[model samples]
Target: MSEAYTGGCACGAIRYEKAGAPIAALHCQCRQCQQRSGTGHASYVVLDRRDDLIVRGELQTWPVAGDSGNVKHNAFCPICGSSVFVTFEAMPEMIAIHVGSLDDPSCFHPGMVTYAARAQQWDRVGPGLKSFAEMPPG
Candidate 1:
């Protein structure tokens, strides 16, 4: 077991803890991610076990229609409007947390880049990382 991970919204209205380490960490450059993050991409860490997550405080979610036609619930703090975590209709067993929401974000090391096809040339991810134009095949 890895060290516990903890973080919350910018205003501290929402808090979360994951009992174990992340299974995967990556940056997504999909259109929806860019729009939601108001940037070129969104960084996320996936926790395979939903039970390891403990979220305290109310979260407001807006369902996003993915390019694949799957629905992803973008969870955020309603008060401070901070994007936090997300749940996907395509993968119900996992939770994707926004790496920016981490108390110590420097601890995150993204190993993959997704949706490279939509990435902006000005916002290119660093080289040598595993990358895919879209979600990798299962």
Candidate 2:
């Protein structure tokens, strides 16, 4: 990607810029992702370098245990309750940004679907992508 990826929260209380292409992009259908997104799945872009992400404005955060039993930090806009990103305790160098929060969401292209076992039958993922019943192997 030539330009930096930029995005913000619904109420504009939080904004960010990521300076590199995503390392991986996928749709997570895990129960927690579903609950947070209020949808069947949550789409995200994984940035290889956490330091490449620059944020402005205060954000509220919540800690939750992931399926792997690792702590994950969910960050959101306190004003709009918009979930922005997540950081994993097991992978501190990576940052996952919610695709929907992107200024140009169309720039995102999910290459895979994860947590397929928990996915609702009515909320199927797109065709022609790699899928895993649970988390993909590293």
Candidate 3:
């Protein structure tokens, strides 16, 4: 069996534990991602199933439609305002967690960067890994 992954919010108001490694972990530099992350890119941990996730907290969400026109739910801790997990209407079986929200964030290793065409030139993601002008057709 795969090791269970665990993490929590900065204030510990929101804690999460899950089994299975991420199916896809990517850094997105889309305009929406930049604004959300307050940087050039937003990191995400895409897990297999919401059932595999165990979270503790009274979270709040502000749902927004993504460029793909999917309902993207932005969930965060109600107390500390730390962005946590999210579920997109396009991908029902997955829960994407913010890497920064992890108690031990070092586990996050970005495999790719999407929307490089919109990425800020001043804020480079540096070398290595594949980059795409837009989310590459999977």
Best by TM-score: 2
For every candidate in turn, the CA RMSD to the true structure comes to: 1.2, 1.0, 1.4
The window of 10 residues in a row where model 3 has the poorest summed lDDT is 1-10
Best candidate according to lDDT: 2
Model 1, 138: alpha-carbon shift in Å? 1.1
Q: What does candidate 3's lDDT look like per residue over 1-138, in tens digits?
A: 355678877798888898886787788888988888888888888888787688888888899988788898988888888888788888888888888987777888888888889989887884797888898786
Which 10-residue window of candidate 2 scores lowest in summed lDDT? 1-10
lDDT of 2 at 123: 92
Q: Order of all candidates by TM-score, from best down to worst?
A: 2, 1, 3
Overall local distance difference test of candidate 2: 0.91
Residue-level lDDT tens digits of model 1 in 2-120? 76778989999999998667878899999888988999999998887777688999999999788888999999999999999999888888898898999989878899999999998
Give the lDDT of residue 72 in candidate 2: 98
Q: Candidate 2 lDDT, tens digit per residue, 1-138?
A: 645888999989899998777788999999999999998999998887777788999989999998789999999999999999999989999889999999999988899999999999889887889999999999
**Candidate 3 lDDT for residue 34:** 86
**Candidate 3 overall lDDT versus native:** 0.83
Taken over the whole model, the C-alpha lDDT of each candidate is 0.89, 0.91, 0.83
